[model samples]
Target: MTDDVTTLAWAYLSRVAEPPCDEIATLVGEVGPLEASHRVAAAEVSDALRERTAARRDIHAAEADLNLLERRGGRLITPDSDEWPTFAFTGFGGAAVRERPQGRPPLVLWAIGPARLDEVAERSAAIVGTRACSSYGEHVAAELANGLAEREVAVVSGGAYGIDGVAHRAALAADGPTVAVLAGGIDVLYPAGHSSLLHRISNAGLLLTEYPPGVRPARHRFLTRNRLVAALGAATVVVEAGVRSGAANTAAWARALGRVVCAVPGPVTSASSMGCHVLLRGGAELVTRADEVVELVGRAGEFADEEPRPTGPLDGLSDAEKQVYEALPARGVRSADEIAVASGLAPTAVLGPLAMLEIAGLARRDDGCWRLVRTSP
Candidate 1:
């Protein structure tokens, strides 16, 4: 919880300047939110800061906004709040982020849910992709989300259609915590069809945004909100994306913040997968399953994927044994003389390998004829 004065100041400042306003954020960092709000109101800040807030400075809605948030059962999370994720936003202080206002951290977040921001972000992974997704993309997103949830790793995603929607629903279906970083206010559910989904998210997970109540989702706001989605997650996974999609923007933010970027490969002919293939070519980790993603974001050695190995019964056979096995007909039996001819081995030598294969259950003898045996993996 935030104190009355401080919360009001944060709310005021949040509205005064659009988010990612480096100038205002810098001013607040220097003089604190309470004084910063007063300075902006009094026009005592630098020209750059003053100009940014000029249009909305006098339109003070702190109290009203707070009341609306409370009425809706939401919280105003300021830097002063216990719920603020300081560790997750540490990268916002990096030189790269400071150079770009779009990548900077938020001054205040409007959130609604039962989960704590910091706790949910401790081991979270952001799953994002384009709004127009194929069934393949949807399946992959759901699988990754469900798998991460089962491992107790929170799933973070924009609460939009396609990949983001699938990820959120899958995480909730698995009875795991998830966080939906919205582009608009927590109260303003964009993509009207997802209104029910958004409310359900608020009940089970969290609906978070930097925008105040009544702020509708705008194009620029969605792009600006990408930074938070990237920052909150330890890793960002792009399940499917076009060459130029919002998911790609989120991945770029993750890279800029030094977070692990993972991509799931799709068919070579899929236009929807071009972005992921581009990422893979540029050295992003190629993640096909949740275990692979967990290995990158989870604690070292905790969720490591097992090394792959051949599961065939012939895997450990010697060259001679393998030749004998291969020489055997897949659907029918073959005699010793026929096997020897097919394997390029002596008729007498074929007997020993055939005996080995039969003993190993890789081959079976019926009426003294050898036929290949198919074993379940």
Candidate 2:
């Protein structure tokens, strides 16, 4: 449990400094959240920190924000809270990640849900893609999300349309937990169309954000939000994306944070999959199925996809056997000489393979002719 003063201080910091406030973050880490709030309020911080807090430092909304949050049935999750995902966010403190505008971990999170944030994130994966997704993309996203849910991996994603919607719906359908990291305030669902979906998530899973209540979403906030989504999951999977999409941005953050990045390949002609192809070409792991994702993100040796093998009847046959099989018609019979001509094999060569095919049940002999056997429906 987090103390009231600490929560208030973090709430104030979250509102005043905006997000990814590296200077303020450093101040908080050094003096603690409560004291850092006091220092910033009294103008006792460094020049950089002062500049960051100069505008909104006078706005004391911590108490009011807390009141509104409580009214909305939400709570503030601070670093001191046991539910805070300390391990998941460890990468945000890295020197390389800190320099970027969207790299820093949130000062505090406003969340509404029943599940513990830390527990849900322990074995989670982020599934992201374009809003303008194709049907093929939708099918793949649903399958991946459903499989992940069945395996007890929480699905983390932005609660938007298209791929995000499909992922959440699939997870819910599977009766699994999910987290929606939003750009706007936790109470303010940005896309009005997803209100029902977002509400269900708040009841069953989690709705998290760095912004205080009543804050509307902006374009820049979405980019800032991507970092949290990337940090929460052990791996980030992109089902589909345009060349320059928010999904791609999230994938970049995942890579920067040293998280596994996986991309699903789509048709070369699909404009929606251009970004995933670009990622694949640039060294992202190619993930076609959910098992492959589990192998990459799950515990070591806990999961491994079986190597795909050829399933065709002629898979292990010699060239002559395959030619003979191919030459045999399904609807009618062919004499050995005709099969030989059709297979481009000598008459003598066709007889031996025909006998082998018959013994293997791949071919059926009728009087003096042969035809392919339909082994499966």
Candidate 3:
């Protein structure tokens, strides 16, 4: 199919199609996107689906997102493109062609950042847990992510609060690429608190979303996103989760995909670790470090990590973050607005980096502003 036709077709379908919809996936697969688009436009499909398509057949939003994302250094990758995550499309996710398939993968993935999606997904481990993770859960998550990073294994996680944030931070701190699978549009930073972290991931790692540019993260979207996380990675690791949590959902998806599932043991008394224990008892392997995770996801000796811990806090920050740090006056405080102008980034963008800097002990926040912390002994 022609590039223009293919792009516009998938773009339109993506906006209107409810993802993981087996019917749409099968239809598009049997007949190319261009033909499928024609079918929908001609009212040859189901009345309900045709009505849905008619309502969103105007590709303005998707086209706008394509232009905006390209300008921002990202793109929409489809099955025809080499940058596509073929494993997710063809692996367990794509099984059951003869019978009615149980599930389907995304038609297109919006990727933002420096790392290539194919490379990042090649040998990845997903670390997931509760938003209100405990200290032990947080520590184990960092250890696993850092170790995985040192071995060139890209870390994958929902870029949310708690364990997910810790996993992304640890991988970035280790100077390896990490993919943030956002539930919402890549342009709309949800959880607002992790904007700096997510921005840095997009620069040094990768940002992935199945949603359109302006789509907000709905509760259902998160559940759908967990499957992508499970499908992209070779193994899914539940660091800490409640009895019924998103981490558990990822593990379930991994198990369904016939992928390895691992869980770290937490204190028996802790509520956060209960999910991990459940997975452990339900056939998930017990893993403590990155090497174990690597072994499951890679060939022997590949991604073997001799070093497990990070060197220091500032080691893995993105260039943008480093610029923000450099812009800080050595002896005085600078408001976020001042830092934004100095660093050539927007004021809203500055807040995330500032928050991260403070967490890294490289900067401190005073009354409504920030200042660098003394590092010399």
Candidate 4:
């Protein structure tokens, strides 16, 4: 019975334009309440010869494919299946799958993974961003994935270049579960270069798609794919992106779906940072470090000790010295130019404070500039 429903649902999805979900719901009096059989019979299918001809062709093709899959003993999962993700029982999932003039979700999600659907939901977090990411962007993504893995958080991302690749690699290196939601078929590896990464994810994590096996990615498909990423994650983080990049689209989707949206701040001069800046301006939480992400996930206790310590000697320092100390990062060497930029002070103005900080043992100079040194506990 489940298999029959799956087949019928898949057939109906393949034949119709994304059904106008609201209209269908109004007709049925509840979202996703219309059965596949009912949908097929009630389609206000046009009688025009060309329209009818196309519909018939699509229906025939879907039926033929279903028969072949059944004959081959392939499994199918419908919304009624126990394995259906719990989110699917909510209005969000209904909205995702309902027919819209734009499109519909796959009637049956074809999946192969070590973790069950619910487990995927439990641990997932979407890490999305531009394909052309800067080195800093890559570093941020890797570090975030590493932190998430340490906490047993599952990393979810599109299997694209730049930030996506880094996120997946970090998760794999950490031996944590990860999932790559594809714009194409489970069998088709888009971009070709990430074939190894894709294979590793399938073996170690999960690889999923709305499209059936053997379908290649198309331009429009990626936009549609973003919704799935948003749906799957409890939150979405944009590591780095351009003003108009696809990451913004994914972030928007996350917001629409009521998922937490996070943006990692970068050098303001970087073009890739523009999207993140915009997101921050629009109320996305600003994340500068990995613990910020953990905190955003409400696991603050997991990272409370990782918080940045007070910059420098708070004892007996003048106001100016305190200001300079406060501006320095807890660790890492910095050149004078970098320190000046960070402190928002001229190099000349900073020298006095630097001398004070060094004498007070609140900071130390290495190479050319200053670094905030932690006092003994």
Model 4 C-alpha lDDT per residue in residues 82-112, reported as the tens digit of each score: 7667442123333553444223334455555
Ten contiguous residues with the weakest lDDT in model 1: 300-309
Tens digit of per-residue lDDT, candidate 2, span 1-377 = 55787888889999888787888888888989989999999989999888988999999989999998887788899888889885434343367666765677788899998889999878899999999999999999999999999999899999989999999999999999999999998778969999999999998999999998888999999999998998888889999999999999999988777788899999999999999999999878788877777766765222123333456776788667887988998688999999987876667778999999999999999998998898763
Cα error, candidate 1, residue 343 (Å): 40
Stretches > 4 Å off in candidate 4 = 1-75, 88-106, 299-377
Off by over 4 Å in 1: 87-94, 300-377
What TM-score number comes out for model 4? 0.66
Error of 2 at 211 (Å): 1.0
Give each prediction's root-mean-square deviation over alpha carbons. 12.2, 12.2, 17.2, 10.7
Model 1 backbone overlap count: 0
* Local distance difference test, candidate 4: 0.69
**Could you give candidate 3's per-residue lDDT for residues 313-370 as a string of tens digits?**
5569865577688778888888998998787655666788888888889999988878
User: In candidate 2, which residue pairs clash?
Assistant: none
Ranking by TM-score: 1, 2, 3, 4
